[model samples]
Target: METTPFFIFLFIHLSCLVLGFGSVMVTDLYGLMWIRDRVRFTQVISVSGVTEKFIWAGWIGMVAAGIPLIILKGEIDNLMTIKLFFVALIAINGIILHFLHKKVGKYKKGEHVPNLFMFRLMLSLFVSQLSWWGALLIGFLHRHVTTIINWPDMPWLVSGLILGAFLMIWGLGEIYFKVKEV
Candidate 1:
């Protein structure tokens, strides 16, 4: 067995996956602390700069490897395109979260992190989770599930699935944020 460029890219991409998921999980945990424990939230976030940096690194690596991996893998079909769409969603959500975190970082120690703001943050997190995990699953199953989607109706089906996931996950996130305690 010989290691090829494709294999190297795949490994880089998958390795980034683990790092990315870990960062996302830790970020969500900090968000939960923001909801449940203000004191701990500040302390944890203050020291979490390194983890946040690691996430950016992983995200960049994944995106960098993904383009070549796609080309190396050959012609993309509907499912692959949809998976790419989810990857775009993940990147978009990440940008949103970046700005939101900037706003959050400006928060003074004694001041409250507003519900509306936190709700927005939670919604962003939900989007991140949905897209990251969705894209990962779709990538893993893409070859196996390629036959399932009808090519002619692919756009509609992909759109519907993305919309449904967004709405369902965002709704659940909103509920959690709403009922969360200080």
Candidate 2:
């Protein structure tokens, strides 16, 4: 059988997803390590800037490649619709986090730290988890929704829900810790 355009699109889509995810993971890991070690403000700022740049570039690359791929694949169905929603959510959260990081880096000793920045960061992380869960759900539903309806056997949905819950708890913990410090 001849190869379908859908397969081509799928390949490109998956490639971009992998690359984008890897970029984010590397950035987050680096940030976590830097923060844990109590790095200098200038070092932190530089690291954040570099990581943020990678994230933006990866995101833009994904978008630039994904739109045409989706178009070529055909009309958006339920799964694609859901996936798009999560993708949009991820983009919004990323933009918010980018600004929040800038604000956080601006704080100096004796300067009153704004809770709004922390709030925004917390929300962004929460939304990031939501996006991941949504993506997982859409992926799972895409495979078996036409035949299966049970919740337990649905790995994607279950994983997504679990991840979402974890994200909420993580965000709450961060808020609690910050409040204690204040």
Candidate 3:
């Protein structure tokens, strides 16, 4: 096995992960502060706007690097499939978040934002975080654990996550609306 190419792509992949996840974490933190009334909504929007570039840069880089990594690895196992699933979900969620940000950006700091829109925004954020974390975890397990322990097949793992994410999204929306009502 020619490890040089694999190691190069791995480094690139890890770098992109750090950039994307770090930017996302910052954006989510800002959003949390806004939701808690500790920061102005405008500030959150501003931060998100700025961080979006870095996020996309990292995303694009990851895809670019991932192709070579996959090729070098010479096979996609169940775990790799799970990681790919999460990557796809993250890409789709990012598109939704882009539009949601555009819609939400119109409101002033103290102005009313519709419950539906707010819920969607929260949902998008949740999806983004979940997908990123899922991909990261799957990647780690694929690299480090699959050989050491027997793992469930792709459908089982993915289905379980889908169910869990669905429930969490519903609960998060309920909590967001209830907090707003208070």
Candidate 4:
């Protein structure tokens, strides 16, 4: 079969997904380290601000490209379904992270909230990273599963399922933490 435009678009979309997720992970890890007093908060904040901006740009690119790519392809199989689900999850997490970043700014500026609220926000960030990472993994693997899988081994499909389970756990833990905080 000829390589389709959809494949090109998918490649770009995946590239954005990787960049966005990787940026978030780096920022979150840096923030965590700073929180633990192992690094300078100022450094973490600076890096996070830069990375977050890049992530947002990448996300916008992905959405802009993905719409046409999905429509053009017009084939929603199991892998596509799995990819879309995780993409939605990543978008949701991005929204939550936007607000969480705002809260973190406010906190930095001496806006005090209940400790519970802070804890909830922290948990949200954690879950956001987890979901973002999981989604990227699913999206990447879904493209390769069937073609590479043996009749019994089913390597890629099995990994995708595992990733999906991890995504669910991440989302549930986020909700649980938020509720407990409140």
Task: List the candidates' TM-scores in order.
Answer: 0.76, 0.61, 0.83, 0.66
Pairs clashing within candidate 1: none
Predicted model with the maximum lDDT: 3
Task: Please list the residue runs of candidate 3 whose C-alpha ends up more than 4 Å from where it truly belongs after superposition.
Answer: 147-150, 154-182
Model 1 spans with C-alpha error above 4 angstroms: 1-3, 33-39, 143-152, 160-182
Give candidate 4 regions above 4 Å deviation.
1-4, 108-114, 147-182
Model 1: per-residue Cα lDDT over 68-180, one tens digit each:
98777666767667777777777777788878877877888779887767778767878888888877877778545552443435765765777777778768767776777
For each candidate in the order shown, give its overall lDDT on alpha carbons.
0.74, 0.64, 0.82, 0.66
Tens-digit lDDT string for candidate 3 (1-182): 24998888989999998998899999999998877889988888889999998999999999999999888777777666666777887887889899999988888767888786778887788878978988888788767766222345555566567857776876878787788877
What lDDT does candidate 2 reach at residue 100? 80
Instruction: After the best TM-score superposition of candidate 2, give how far the Cα of residue 86 lies from its true spot, in angstroms.
Output: 1.3
- Clash tally, candidates in order: 0, 0, 0, 0
Model 2: residue 76 alpha-carbon error in angstroms: 1.8
Model 3 weakest 10-residue run by lDDT: 147-156
